[model samples]
Target chain A: MLKATVYVTLRESVLDPQGHAIQGALHSLGFDEVKGVRIGKYLEVNVDTTDKAQAEERVREMCEKLLANTVIEDYRFEILEG
Target chain B: MRVAVIQFPGSNADVDMYQAVEDIMGAPVDYVWHSHNDLSAYDIILLPGGFSYGDYLRCGAVARFSPVMEQVIKAAEEGKLILGVCNGFQILTEAGLLPGALLRNASLKFLCKLSELRVVNNSTAFTQDYSQDEVIQIPIAHGEGNYFCDEETLAKLQANNQIVFCYENENPNGSINGIAGIINERGNVLGMMPHPERAVHAWMTSDDGKRMFTSILKTWREKNGVTTNA
Candidate 1:
């Protein structure tokens, strides 16, 4: 099986209000040096195939189709096979 | 006009939408469950507010795949009127029936209150009862209502006069261009964050929302050769 981990974040050009609120909360809790933060989603999927190329392709299709909204988010994935 | 109000599992505004259409607008309405795929009989399709699928994955991400949404898409393509409010708006965007996405409010808090909206283009079916440039008040309740689109889409929207409502004086959710509501390029689909259904009663925020329903009825009547009561 191949395990894929995907990270999704707001596009750099877009503002992240949730991240901004978290930054404020972190600062209030004494993590004052934090300059910025952008909230996002992470997903892990296990594919049944061992073919590395096919698994990566399937993961990309998943991300494009449903895992992430490409309109406002940027997503990258890492795959591990066992 | 025959109106259909979709009832998703977690939808809390279905009653309000049904009441707004049947009682306030004097139109026949059908409460269609999300699983019902047939939607050919409805003249107007209303997607009401409230979280669907518990807002899992995304506000409307899961609901977008509902079997009924396929019929909704077909209706939109047939130029049938479709109105999506609050979570409904999110579903439409997620379904790609409308451009742009609704993000977390800029304040990072759920906003539930009355908001003033300026009618940007009253030529669409949803805004005919409202005058161009008129300011109206409606209640908005949602955690993710901040509308966003890329520059290309924004430019196209402005070029096509697709933006129907703009926040007046204050932008409560930080929507780009103060856009509170917009119609699709074909003008048959409208998605807005405000609760027009909730405003159908005088006891609610204001009667301004009733005008939207009236506008739809008026348009349908005109198209069907029935003289409008206006």
Candidate 2:
């Protein structure tokens, strides 16, 4: 089994409201040095494929088809063989 | 317009959305709790606003792991019309259905007020009822509504005209480029902070918000007709 870890994040231009909230909290807590914040998503998928390339391709398809919305998000994945 | 309004534990606006959808479109609307797994049959799937899961981790963080989200994500992938309002918008971003996270209000307060939004793009299925640059008044109530993004991504969105709605005048939560709502490239998914369902009636100030629903209904009808006729 191949495990694929996908990290999906909003494109640089899309607004990130949650990260701003956290930055506010951090600033309030005296983390004033923090300049900017952005938030995205992390997803893990277990693929049943022996070929690493095939697994990566399938994972990419999954990200494109449903795992990620490519319009506003950019996704990268790492394949782990177990 | 058969719609399914998914309800989570902390979702406070599901019923209001239900009423607006049912009353405005006179369509059968279902209140699908967060635990229900099946959402394949619904024409439209709505994730209503409210403090889901007590805003744990983030506004919509805990709710992102809901059982119903799996189905919602699946439906969204199938090219169904999905709308996320307020907290629902947060959930969509957290679930990777939409872009960017909703942060604290720029004023650092739980803001609740009526705001004007300019429809920047009317080409999408969700905004077909309104002309481009039409300004509509809608209510916004949330603490984490600030939007942020990197410079490059901002330029790309601008180049693609992906920004669907923006603040008319003053920035509400300091969203980058005053973003109020945005749609995916395919135009099948939308995530926005302002509550359109709250403004669908004259009593709610204006029926301007109804335009969104009308647009979706018209698109669904047209698409369905085209499919059946073919």
Candidate 3:
């Protein structure tokens, strides 16, 4: 079995109001070193396939079809074997 | 005209849309389940506002894959009139029936209040009753209503006159160019965050939305060659 860890983040062009709010809160908390904060989604999927190539293909398709909206979000995934 | 108000599992505004079409507009309307596969019987499709699928992943993300959305896409291709309000608008964008996506409000809060909007284009089937630049009040209720699109798409929308409504003065959600509503290139499909149906009655707040339903009826009548003196 293989596990795919996916991370989805808003594209650079799109504004992240939640992230901005978080940055503000951090500033109030005296985290002066924090220049920016962007929020995103993380998902971990366990693929039943043993073939690494097939797992990668399936995970990519999942991200494109349902997990991530490519219009405003960019996604990357890493596969782990157990 | 026959209207279908689509009802997804988490949809809360389906009855509002149904009443708007049936009681207010005096048109025949029905509620269609999300699992329904056919939409050919309905002349107008209305997607109402609500947290479809509990708004789990993203607003309208999971609901976009509902079985009925395929028919919605097909109906759009056939030039059927479609109106998506709030969550419906989000679903339309996720379904690719409309361009761009709606993000969280800039304030990061759910906004529920009347918003002033200017009619940008009155030539389309949805807004012919309103004069160009006419300002009307419609209530918006959503946490994710900020509209965003790439610059190239914005240019095309501007050039094509697909922008149907713009926020009059105060940009509530910080949408791109204060876009309140937009129509598809074919002019048959419209998506707006504001709930025109909720504003149809005087008691509810504003009656300015009455003309929008009338405009749709008028356009449909003109296309079908039905003469109505009312």
User: Could you say which candidate leads in DockQ?
Assistant: 3
How accurate locally is residue A52 in candidate 3, as Cα lDDT from 0 to 100? 90
Candidate 2 B-chain TM-score: 0.96
For model 3, how does the per-residue alpha-carbon lDDT over A1-82 read when each residue is reduced to its tens digit? 9999999999999999999999999999999999999999999999898999999999999999989889899999999994
Off by over 4 Å in 1: B228-230
Q: Which DockQ-derived CAPRI band holds candidate 3?
A: high
Instruction: Compose the digit string of candidate 1's lDDT tens values, residues B19-104.
Output: 98987678889999999999999999999999999999789989999999999999999999999999999999999999999998
In candidate 3, stretches whose alpha carbon ends up further than 4 angstroms from where it belongs are none
The second chain of candidate 1 has a TM-score of 0.98
Tens-place lDDT digits, model 2, residues B83-146: 9999999889888887666766766788899999999999998899899899999999988887
For every candidate, C-alpha RMSD to the true structure in Å: 1.3, 7.2, 0.8
Q: What is the lDDT of candidate 1?
A: 0.92
lDDT of 3 by residue, B104-126 (tens): 99999999999999999999999
Candidate 1's displacement at residue A30, Å, is 3.4
Candidate 2, CAPRI quality class derived from DockQ: incorrect
* Standalone chain B TM-score for every prediction: 0.98, 0.96, 0.98
1 or 2, which is superior by lDDT? 1
Error of 2 at B184 (Å): 1.0
Q: Where's the lowest-lDDT run of ten residues in candidate 3 chain B?
A: B16-25
The residue pairs in collision within model 1 are none
Q: List the residue pairs that clash in candidate 3.
A: none
| Candidate 1 docking class | high
